[model samples]
Target: MRTKVAIIGAGPSGLLLGQLLHTFGVDNIILERQTPDYVLGRIRAGLLEEGTVSLLDQVGAGARLHQEGLVHHGVELAFGGARHRIDMHAATGKTVTIYGQTEVTLDLMNARKAAGLTSVYSASDVKPHDFDTDHPRVTYVKDGVSHEIACDFIAGCDGFHGVSRASVPASAITSYERVYPFGWLGILSETPPVSPELIYNNHERGFALCTMRSSHRSRYYVQCPLDDHVDQWSDDRFWDELKRRLDQKAADELVTGPSIEKSIAPLRSFVAEPMRFGRMFLAGDASHIVPPTGAKGLNLAASDVHYLSQALREYYDEKSSAGLDGYSARALARVWKAVRFSWWMTSMLHKFPDEGEFAARIQIAELDYLVSSKAASTSLSENYVGLPF
Candidate 1:
């Protein structure tokens, strides 16, 4: 079988690319390692930058998002027994919404299917063919038999663990990486939010965050040892720690009883240079990984797709490869900005026990100054809310 484009991984990047290609009257197919239900049900990053929301609307996938998303004008930076708001609207003249990634994915899926496109799920062991040639293909096993789908090119949106990157020679890809000393163990509770805006707190005890996933659901996180396990903490202990770190004001705040789900996320910064090789190109987490402090993950992926989609559209319609040729370095420009912003935010907050008392005090002092100075707070808010796609 063959297609104009063969995309790996049905995550946002891959799915959105397929939808964009269809908009340009190009035919494409997407292969995902996860089941459709799983991909649709996976609850992850929800904050969509204004640019990303605009892309969704242009691609015909914003019906559910525009209706269900909680639009936020700013986030609260809490430290030193006080809470400060970094007004995003005032800083960047932009807005971000508290819509989960799952909502966006479902919306994309519905729009794609309505436009007569289907994604094959549970497709494991995807192999990119002819990396050095202009025409390449993706071969994978769907159910019981192996199949090869030839295509003009392949988009490796399979994320960090996917096989497309592995297909490139080790010598050709230069990777830069740094692993942090701590991780965020977050929980999703079936309760109402305690605050109007997202709260990010840094205390000697730990780094904690309070935010809402939806009207009826609250999302919370706290710093833990990099190797800490979720089983180490109980439901009661979770709420207690959150309240202590957050300094809950109301008695009925965060009605935490059942611990629905918990996850540990390691902090890291990863980037692979030259995201393209012959017929295969990388997009999304497949090329870079940023700590979630800046809330840039989903937006970055969407931005990469927006560029890639534009490039592919130019190549197919105008018979010009100028846009396609500029994909990597162009995407890298924004990627590194986000990488730096995420690292900076992570450093500005998160207390490090290994650094001793002096270092911890210095971190607090810096946070104090950052929030105290309007210019500094503006920089933080601009970086946190992000720029155009």
Candidate 2:
């Protein structure tokens, strides 16, 4: 098979890249190891910053997004049973939308399908070959038959394990990573959100977040000890712990329902230097990862694809590879910014016995300082709300 670009992984990044190329009158084939249903069903990041929403709109992929998304203007910070609101819109003049990553994937998949595009699924033998040559090839199995896909360029949007990144020479990619001490235990409940706005609570027990998936459903998370067995906790125990951490008052309204879903999300930070390797380029989880604290994983992936598509559109015509040349450095600039923010938030809210009480006090002091000062708050809010593209 042949196309202008052979994209690995049909997740958000790959799908969006195809749509972007189509707009430039460039045709591309997206290959996936998983079926469309599985790709659209993965539970992942749900927040979209202004730039993310704007990109979707420009690509004509925002119809359902704009209609079904919940635009949140602000979020609440709760401590000592007192709630403080950060006016994200008033502070940054922009708002974020709450739409799950799976929803975005589904949206892009449906849109691309309607356009008569087919993304190969259940494909085996998905591996990178001939990437050092002018023509890169993606070998895979489809419909019980082996196949070879060759293209002028390859995009690795297949997450951390995708083949695109593996094609690169090991000496060329510089990687950095840090693993945290705890994870977030999240659950989706049928009850309405306990708070109208999303709430971030730093309670004595741990950190808890209360957000909504929709009007009738809520998404909540609480920090768990690194080795805590989630299967051991009863529903009552979960609620009691959340209440203690957030300092919820008895009089406050609370939602009651069976937890429909539960899972642990390990905290970690990762970035691969020089995101581009010859004719093959890495994007999305294939290149970087940030803890869920900052809601950056999805948007970060979008940024990479956005740059990749623009480069392809320009380079295809003029034979100029300026954008491709600067791909890694340019994307890394933003990636590092998110890296710092995610690490900082994770440190500030999580417990570390090795740090001693003095260190813990300093963390609280930092939060207090941000809340009390515009300069500090702006820095936090800007990153928390979002940075300009």
Candidate 3:
């Protein structure tokens, strides 16, 4: 088979890119290592930056999102036994939509199916060949049969553990990574959130966040040791701990319920330099990873997709390689900024095992200053709502 672009992975990035290309009259096919159900079942960040929402609108996938997604002008930061609100809209003239990534994937997948875009799910041994040459091809196996797709370009949107990045030679890629000492033990429950807006808390016990997918479904997280297991935490104990760490008002309003989903995600910041290689380009988690503190993971992916989609559009329409040639530098420039913001938020809110009491006091001071200083709060709000694409 021959197409203009051969996309790897059926995740949000890959699916979103494919849809955008299809809308531009660019022929492409998506390959996934798992079933559609498996991809949709994966829970991920729900905060949608303004740019991301606009991208969905461009692809005609915003009908469900705009109807179901929550719009928030601000988020609360709880520290020193108080809850402080940062007006993101007032600070930066922007707002965020709380729509789960799973829903975004479903929207794109349904849109792709309706448009008759080809996507190969459960594709095994997916590999890109001859990307350095003018003609490139992707080979994979489906149903025990081998197949090849000859394309002008390849999009490596597969993610961190996907074959896209790993396929590149180590000498050509420079990776920078930092694994935090703690992990987030999060739970999803069918209960109302403690607050209407998301609350990011810095408490003596640990860092905790109160967020939600909707009015009735809450997602909560607390910092825990790396060795902590899900079996070690009970529903009651988790609620009790969450309440203890929150302010009096938030704690009193908190509702407890059985956890529908629970998991421990380790915090880390990772970035791979030069997202483009030959005719293949990496986007989303394939090139970088940020801690969940600032909720930048999915947003970063969207920005990368936006850049890449635009680049490919230019290449095909104007017959210009300018955008494609500049994809790496353009994407990485924004990627690094988000990496810094997430790292700063994680460092300020979470406890460090080695820092002792001095660091704890310093963290509290920083949080205090952030709430008191309009400049500092606006900076935080700007990054939270997302930097301009």
Candidate 4:
């Protein structure tokens, strides 16, 4: 089989890119190593930057998103037994949409199916070859049979562990990573959220976040040791710890319920430089990863798709290579800013293992200044809402 572009992985990035290209009359194919259900089963961050929401609108996938998504004009930061709110909308004139990543994937998948686009799922050993040459090809085994796709370009949307980035020689890619000592122990509950807007809290014990997918469904998280397991945390224990971290008023009003889903996620900041390798380019988790503190993972991916899709469109529409040639620099410029913001937020909220009392005091000082100073809050709000694409 042959197409203009071959997209690896069927996650949001791949599907979004495929949908955008198809909408513009660019022929493309998507390949996935897992079944559709497995892909949608993975839970992820839900906060949507303005850029991501707009991109969804452009691709005709915003009907469900705009209808169901909850818009928040501000987020609260709780520290020192007091609650302070960051005016994200007043500071930046932009708000974030509270929509689950799962819903986004479902919408994209449904849109793809309705548009009659092709995607190969449950394919094994999917690999990209000859990306550096004028002609690129992708090969995979499906149902015990081998197949190949010859295309003009390949999109490495397969994610961090996928074959896309691994296909590039190590010498050609420079990587930077930082693995934190703790992870986020999170749960999804069926009860109403403790707060209308999301809350980022710093307590003497650890960091906790109060966020929700909708008015009735809530998602919450607390910092935990890296070795902590789900079995060790019962529903009551999780709720108790969450309340302890929140302010007294919220804690008093907090509603507890059985957890529908529970898991722990490690925090890390990773970036692989030069996202482009000849005809193949990396987007989303394939190239960079940020701790969920600032909720940049999927947003960064959307920004990447923003650049990659535009570049690919220009390549086909105008027969120009300038956009494609500049994809790496443009994407990385924005990626690094998010990296800094996520890192900063993580530092301010999380308790580092090696951080002595002095470091903790300084963290408190920083948070105090951040909430007290208008300029500082504005900076935080702008970064939180998202930098321009």
Candidate 5:
């Protein structure tokens, strides 16, 4: 088989990139190791930056998002037995939408199907070959039969652990990472959210976040030891721990229900440099990962796709390699800023076991200054709402 671009992954990054490229009149095919049902079953971040929403709109996948996604203009910081609001819309004239990543993927999947785009699911041993040469190709085994695809380019949106980045020699790439000492124990419940906007809480006990997938489905999380397991946490214990970390008012208004989903996610900041390797380019998790404290993971992926899609479009439309040559440097600039923001947020909100009381006081002081100062709040707002793509 042959295509202009072979996208290795059916996650949002690859799917969005494929859609964008198709709209640009560039043909592409997607290969995934997992089935479509498995892809939709993975739970992920629900916050959408304005830039991410715009990308979906560009691909004609924003109709359902606009109909169902909740729009928030501000977020609250809880500390010192109180809650303070950061007016993101007031500060930056931008708002974030509460749309689940799964929904975004489903929307993109539906759009792609409607357009008759090619996507190979449940194809095992999928690999990109000869991406370093002028003629690149991808190979996979489907139904125990081997197949190969000759393509002009390859997109490695498979993620940090996928074959795309793994295909690059160790000497050709550099990685930076910081694995945090804690993890978030989160749960989803069929109940109204405690607040209209998301609340990020910093407590002496640990950090907690109250976010939602929709008006009626609340998603909440509390910091825990890195080694903690989901089996150790029951619905009652989770809710009690969450209440202890929240302000009195939020605790009073909090509605608890049987958790439909529960999991513990370790926090980490990871980045692999030089996103481009010859004819193959990496986008999204394949290139970078951020702690979820700032809600930047999926948005970062979208930004990578934004830069990548543009670069690919320019390559085909204007017959220029300038954009392709600059894709890595351009994407990395934004990737690092988000990494910094996510690290900052994790530092400010999470309790480090070794840091002790001084660090706690410092965090309180930082949060106080952040909410009290207009400049600091604006800086947070701008980063949270997302920087321009």
Candidate 6:
């Protein structure tokens, strides 16, 4: 098969890119190693920056999001037994939409199907070949048959552990990473959220986040040892532990329920430099990862797609290679800023194992300053609402 672009993975990045390219009059095919259900089954970040929502609107997939997604103007930071609200909208003139990543994938998937686009799910052994030359193609195995797609360019939207980045020669890519000592033990419950807005708490016990998928379905997380297991945290135990970390007001108002989904995710900050490799380019998790503290994971992917789709459109419409040539540096600039923000939030909100009383006191002081000073609050609010795309 031949196409203008061959995309790897059927996750939000790949699907959104395909939709955007199709809207831009670019022919593209998506290859996925998992089924459609599997892709939508993955629960991910629920926060969407204004820029990300705009991209979805551009692709005509924002109808459901606009109708169902909750918009938050502020976020609360709880520390020292009190909660301080950061007015994100007042400070940045922007707002974030609380919409699950799964819903975004579903909307894009439906849009792709309605447009009769090509997507090969459950394909195995997918690989990109000859990306260093003008001619680049992708190969995969499906239903015990081998296939190859000849395309003008290849897009690696797979993920951090995907074949897209793994295919690259180690010497060609420079990687920087830091794995945190703790992981987040999260649970999804069918209960009303304790607070109308999301609450991020920094307590002597650990870090706990109170977020929701909807008004009735809440998602909560508490920091735990990296080696902790889901079985070790029962529903009652998780609720009890969460309450212990919350302030008196939130603890009193918190509702407990049976957990429908629970898992532990280790925190890490990673980036692979030079997102472009000849005719093939990496976007989204294929190039970088950040701790979820600042809720930048999915938004970063959207920004990468924005830069990439624009580059491809320019290449086709104006026959210009400038955007393509500058894709990596441009995307990395935004990616690094987000990485720094996520790291900073993680550091300020989470209790470190080895960091002694001095470090703890410093964190308290920083949080105190962050809430008391308008400049610091505005900075945090701007970053939280997202920087300009």
Cα lDDT over the full model 1:
0.86
Each candidate: RMSD: 1.4, 1.5, 0.7, 0.7, 0.5, 0.5
Error of 3 at 182 (Å): 0.5
Per-residue alpha-carbon lDDT of candidate 4 for residues 1-389, written as tens digits (9 for 90 to 100) = 99999999999999999998997789999999999999999999999999999999988899998999999999999998889998989999999999999999999999999999999999999999999999999999999999999999999999999999999999999999999999999999998999999999988889999999999999999999999999999999999999989999999988889998999999999999999999999999999999999999999999999999999999889999999999999999999999999999999999888888898899889999998999999999999999999
Residue-level lDDT of model 5, residues 1-389, one tens digit each, is 99999999999999999999999999999999999999999999999999999999999999999999999999999999999999999999999999999999999999999999999999999989988899999999999999999999999999888999999999999999999999999999999999999999999899999999999999999999999999999999999999999999999999999999999999999999899999999999998989999999999999999998999899999999999999999999999999999999999998999998999999999999999999999999999999999
Among all windows of 10 consecutive residues in model 2, the one with the lowest summed lDDT is 247-256
Error (Å) of candidate 5 at residue 210 is 0.3
Model 6 spans > 4 angstroms off: none
Model 1 Cα lDDT, one tens digit per residue, 180-267: 9999988988888778789888877888888888988888888889877888888787878777787545223667758677888898
Q: RMSD in Å for candidate 4, one decimal?
A: 0.7
Clashes of 4: 0
Count residue pairs with overlapping backbones in model 1: 1
* Per-prediction TM-score to the true structure, in the order listed: 0.97, 0.96, 0.99, 0.99, 0.99, 0.99
Candidate 4 error regions (>4 Å): none
Could you give me the TM-score of model 2 versus the true structure? 0.96
List clashing residue pairs in candidate 3.
Answer: none
Model 6, CA-based lDDT: 0.96
- State the TM-score for model 5: 0.99
lDDT of 6 at 119: 99
Using TM-score as the yardstick, the better of models 1 and 3 is: 3
* Candidate 1: pairs in clash: 46-100
